[model samples]
Target: MALYQQVTGLEPHPKSDGDFTGLNREDGLVIGFQRVDGYPAPRWPDHRSPTASHLLQGQRGPGGSRGRLLELGAGKPDHQPHELARARVLTDPAGHPFCIVRG
Candidate 1:
């Protein structure tokens, strides 16, 4: 959650319950996080689990500006598919795929 906050600059919304944590953006985009017991890690650009979340118009990263997600603990896959030229595929510390579309 801290990683996301640093990357997007959107603070988490007030928690209704400890089980769920979420962040609400001014544009009405709300990202929610919940714990599911024994939930398997998702496969990127695949059938089982896809880009569960996507941040539209993400800036094209370069150097220190190249999305601090990696420094913040995001994972980068070894290979990216051709379909995702404009979107960068990355995983959180938990291995959930997120796409950052070039703005």
Candidate 2:
């Protein structure tokens, strides 16, 4: 939540249920956190690994300027190419894996 505020300069609206918490932006970006047992970080460049999931890359700027990648997960692993064409994976602070691909 602090990082989201730092990056977007906007406060996140909080919502919770049981052990799960979610921070949301009006623009539809949602960040979720939950307590769970035995979560493992996904391996890099290996989408088949446990914890991997697909994410569509959002819009790019004019002249094809690269947009910043926002990953919501556990471990903060470095970005690596996925087995699928035109996709890359990154792990979040919570060890969740995301496969970011161009939309």
Candidate 3:
């Protein structure tokens, strides 16, 4: 939640309960997380292994900026896809992949 708060610049929803955290804004998009025991972190570009699930991204604030994401601990994958040349591919503190693209 701490990382999420920093990156998104949004507060944890008041309704968030134990083992689950969410960010709810007036935009009507609700980002939620539910804790699972021993869940394996997905391997980016490795489809044979368990891969990423929900792909939440920033669209309206600093959270959506490549610079801001890096400032908040997001990282770039070693092998970037050619398609992302004009944009960026970053990993959250938890190694989840998210993209930042221009509108």
lDDT for every model? Answer: 0.67, 0.48, 0.69
Q: Enumerate clash totals for all models, in the order shown.
A: 0, 10, 0
Model 2, range 1-103, lDDT digits (tens) per residue?
3433333344455666667765776787776656566666556645565753443432342111123434322233455545456655544454455544455
- Our tally of clashes for model 2 stands at 10
1 or 2, greater by lDDT: 1
Q: TM-scores, in order shown? A: 0.72, 0.45, 0.75
Choose the strongest candidate by TM-score: 3
Question: Which digits, one per residue and each the tens of the lDDT, describe model 1 over residues 1-103?
Answer: 7666777677688763677888778887877887677777777656576445655427544312345777788888866764648777777787876666666
What are the runs in model 2 whose C-alpha is more than 4 Å off?
Answer: 1-11, 16-18, 27-31, 44-49, 59-84
| Candidate 3 per-residue C-alpha lDDT over 40-73 given as tens digits, one digit per residue, 9 for 90 to 100 | 7766766565644545564455466777777778
Pairs that collide in candidate 1 are none
Residue 70 CA displacement from its true place in model 2, Å: 9.2
Q: Please list all clashing residue pairs in model 2, or write none if there are none.
A: 73-92, 73-93, 73-94, 74-92, 74-93, 74-94, 74-95, 74-96, 75-92, 75-95
Q: Report how far off residue 95 is in candidate 3 (Å).
A: 1.0
